[model samples]
Target: MPTSLNDWLRILENRMLYLSSEAAEQVRLSAKEGKCEGLPLRVAALVQEDGSFHYAIGFEDTPKDEDVRFSDKGVDLIVAPASAGNTGRSMYPFEEIDPATLASWLEKGESVRLIDVRSPAEYAQGIIEGGELMPLHLIPLQMPEAKEGEKLVIYCRTGMRSGQACGFLSQQGKDGALNLRGGIVAWAQQGLPISRADKDVSVG
Candidate 1:
């Protein structure tokens, strides 16, 4: 039992990708057969009628605008926004934060540094309280640092690009980098209020 998001982050990062050499070769061959060579493997979790889950993997030529891409051992993995939620941990190349869990973090007054990695126009619509606007394109240029025991939570419109940000941050050895599972849509769905970008600035 990992109690903190940071703990969960470490656990998930190690499990993001698991492919034996032979399996990797087989996947490449299958992609070539399907005329999907050079395309990324789009993975998703499907909920079965029995309330269990089935993991789906395929080579996707067309990906959504908000999709996140990760490279593991030369294989590109494509993931759609909110797609990670089907699996409890999101299994993207980074740690994921559920909207409800985040709300609880805020309620408990935990140290969380929230970042909104979306375009300026997208960020203006409404943002999670205390979110600092650091557009996805600008993440590399202006990444945030977390203090001891502070969680670095990043999100975009659909939790896709922000997931990319988390991957980048983790590569930089930054801990507690969590992506909001479904972005703001999921947040609003949980009855969590979105506030002005200037108000409720808790993490400074």
Candidate 2:
């Protein structure tokens, strides 16, 4: 076990895991919003049979016996043993923008890459207007090279998969990427417009 934050970071470095500043801020904000301030943020990842990865982020009040605990940029983090061993090259912060804010940006004609990180079937079922299809698992392979001043907004059926996509993009140094909070579910709940096949429907 590590003795202090420094020791923990050193261990993570050796294992090819890292924490980003933005991710640390998200951890802090998540805890505050959950009314569980001071709790550590837990991160776990696993590789699927097809080589894609799945990740989870949540808050924990206490560390488990098998957890690797550490703090960086004032954010406490816990890495599950299984995930720690299976982690990929790196991990980055998960940032999000509310549905209404995203809609407003589009309405204002702001330059943003509205990406639907869902399966083709799901995308065909319904998607935000102007959202391009880019499945979650294919993000790392399909995302274009990061460029300054470019904004990438990713969404899924719910916010879960898009959060993973944001993390993956952040790992590649795509700091401008943001996940659509609540995903299309929230957007539809807000009565926003979505495209179903070739038809445009207003949930509102």
Candidate 3:
């Protein structure tokens, strides 16, 4: 298992103790499989009128814990920290950007270093034009080498990795590292062009 996933499973296992026996077992299996990457592990429990208990696990909404219903619709959707340095990780103000505002900034000749924090493989598959490839796994090693004065606009497929990268950068005192609110998927989905050319050419 990758160390990162194994570490997540360990923390999730401890949280599973709060769940019913069946749910805990399901989580154990899911953790070992690496099937639900980038998604939350949701468990739902239902009690039949005959007092028998039933459980389901995955990303489904269901009832749990003595008649309480579990669902993300009304919840704040805050993802729990998965890594060890979460306490010290700095967070980007991602929720602050609006689409129009972000577009306006992009229109201006901003000196921000637009970053794509996906893996090298993902970057090769596709990426937003002008984005600097800085995979999330490499953030710790690269942060110290980053120049301080430039604004770092980070992004990833759906913004998760970018948010994490921003946090890592903030921990390294690069407070200017702001994540693209929606990432390249959002950018491309909105009809923006993506470039396949070797961007590292310029950085080198």
Candidate 4:
């Protein structure tokens, strides 16, 4: 629930690698037994072209520029931007923003383009405030005319479709399109403001 992009990235850095205290202690002991005792632990996940994921964990003397660096339970952890799509098979250059940051953007009067990648029926049931209905299937066609400098954020019911949409936009050489992590479900769960129309009666 971070209100800014930097805060959101910091949260992601800490949560991306769930190193328990026991695990950290084990790593520390293992490192001490080995010659490279003080080296920092680097954890990375990559999505392959065949819709598969690969993960790596090891000690590194230096961190990459794009790596999100932080500590969890006394264990140093680093995550690269390439690992954003680790939860799925598709990999692209888009980023993920949390609901609180999106809310903060709106509250600060920032010009952000919010696109709802859900179906019309689903959108009618409930939608994030200021989100325009832009079904996932039509993103390729409609996104061509998007403003160059606008920050575009897409979301679906549970973030699956929106992630795909973000990947598609990234592939098209578009910049500044981000997926809303956990989608509108996460948004409402955080008590963020949403808009519901009378056309739908079901809860998504």
lDDT of 4 by residue, 1-204 (tens): 233345445655566446545456656754675455877766445545663333334566566576777777777766654343442222354567888889998899888888887778888887887778877667877883357667788988766567667767776777567778778888999998878754643332
lDDT of 4 at 179: 75
Return the TM-score for candidate 3, rounded to 2 decimals.
0.50
Local accuracy by lDDT, each model: 0.66, 0.66, 0.49, 0.66
- Once model 1 is optimally superposed onto the true structure by TM-score, how far is the C-alpha of residue 197 displaced, in angstroms? 2.3
TM-score of each: 0.56, 0.55, 0.50, 0.54
Backbone clash numbers for all candidates listed: 0, 1, 0, 0
Best by TM-score: 1
Q: Per-residue lDDT for 100 in model 2?
A: 87
Predicted candidate 3 versus true structure: per-residue lDDT over 1-204, tens digit per residue: 012444434434444224334333434443345454334444222333553322222332232332223223222112233322211112222212323445666678655567677777778877666767766666777672336555557777665456556645655566556656556766777776778948453321
Ranking by TM-score: 1, 2, 4, 3
Instruction: For residues 1-204, write the lDDT of model 1, one tens digit per residue.
Output: 233344334434544544445446655755675577897877554443554333334566566665566776677776543332443232324557689999999999999999887767667779988888887667778768788889889987766567667756655666457878778878998899998765343331
Candidate 2 lands at a TM-score of 0.55
Q: Give candidate 4 misplaced runs (Cα > 4 Å).
A: 1-90, 144-149, 197-204
Structure candidate 1, residue pairs in collision: none
